[model samples]
Target: SDGQMPQTREHLLLARQVGVQHIVVFVNKVDTIDDPEMLELVEMEMRELLSTYGFDGDNVPVVMGSALCALEGREEEIGVKAIDKLLAAVDEYIPTPQRDLEKPFLMGVEDVFSISGRGTVVTGRVERGNLKKGDEVEIVGLNKTPLKTTVTGIEMFKKELDQAMAGDNCGILLRGIKRDDIKRGMVIAKTGTISAHTKFLASMYILTKEEGGRHSGFGEHYRPQLFIRTGDVTVVLTF
Candidate 1:
């Protein structure tokens, strides 16, 4: 609690690298430290570190409490009351993501499995929209021609589901897809929602050596694997 750990700083740097705009700090184990000044010192150090990493340190919410105490049902200052305060701070500070379920259904195929009696099952978390049994979906990407199939069944956590929506991590059984027709690195979406493309423009972030990344940079014509959603494809860089 005196200061942020080395791993915490590394994680913060990675978060910044990935364009994280907001953060909520939780200075846990406050009950163990008898000195209020120590807690203040920890908060000050945390804020300074946040500022160093390009975050809005002054305005960031830092909730101090003891999760162990809260779990033990303790009635101390750093117990239940502090847990409530942390939740309130999160509610006020962290903005809710605008996940619209009405958007066209899209899911990145993470894993593919072939069932002896079933045609094929693709499992992944739904990126947007909804799907139900018998809904038609298209397999797109990996520079291949798109393929269309129908959802025969849906299963999540061993339970069969009639439908799935955005953020659902489930497997959908396809009606006529062969095990070899689809694999990882493919996007399954509502028919006509997406298409396969060979090229795209993008802004890139290259991590430095100090950040546990490359020790040297590259120039044009360099071939690097570009990762998008759940797909990773190698491509040549252009000027």
Candidate 2:
């Protein structure tokens, strides 16, 4: 909650790009506003802002509360029950999108490390499909050749598991690949999705001035961090 806020347009665009179907806004500090009319005004303003982002007011859940007071164990006045109600409503209203697991699995590697005698370990969020122990996987990148690997082990939330579905953040052990064969920001996909060469067409927006001048255009040199499947990669953006 303390992190830098994403710009409204950027946040909405990213949420849409990632296939998010609903947005929930938890507005803390209700206790700070003593006037009931002011609270209602704030809620209306939030709804209007979210509407501008294309989220239907009827679909999104917005809750107001005082998190700090609730943490101090002052439950009744701090409105902790409101928070719980919002969570329950979300559970009922928002359904998690099902991934096309039958499609070729592709994950973006976020981190890679050595696991002593067990060999290379890669951590990534599964972007698509379900990964199970003994499933053969391939590590591919725009700049390098594809490397073959087998899932020797899988873990979710620090517990070892036999399988992981899409949307799970997992650390996987690869039996045949070396640590040098893969890198953070490469992609792990089924063999057929692997493509060679750094050039590929993509749809992208000019994110920031720091990303370089506007008419400079998209090309191999503009490698923005791309989050796809369970993998995150630095991609050379091509128009």
lDDT of 1 at 49: 91
Deviating ranges (above 4 Å) for candidate 2: 1-6, 13-19, 75-79, 205-239
**Candidate 2 at residue 55, lDDT?**
79
**Least accurate 10 contiguous residues by lDDT in model 2:** 1-10
- Top-scoring candidate (lDDT): 1
lDDT for predicted candidate 2 compared with the true structure: 0.74
TM agreement with the true structure for every prediction:
0.74, 0.76
- TM-score, prediction 2: 0.76
Give lDDT: candidate 2, residue 199.
51
Question: Tens digit of lDDT per residue, candidate 1, span 12-56?
Answer: 898998878888998888877988888888989899999999999
What is the TM-score (0 to 1) of candidate 1?
Answer: 0.74
lDDT of candidate 2 over 76-155, digit per residue (tens): 55577767866877887788777767877778888889988898889988888888889888888744567888899998
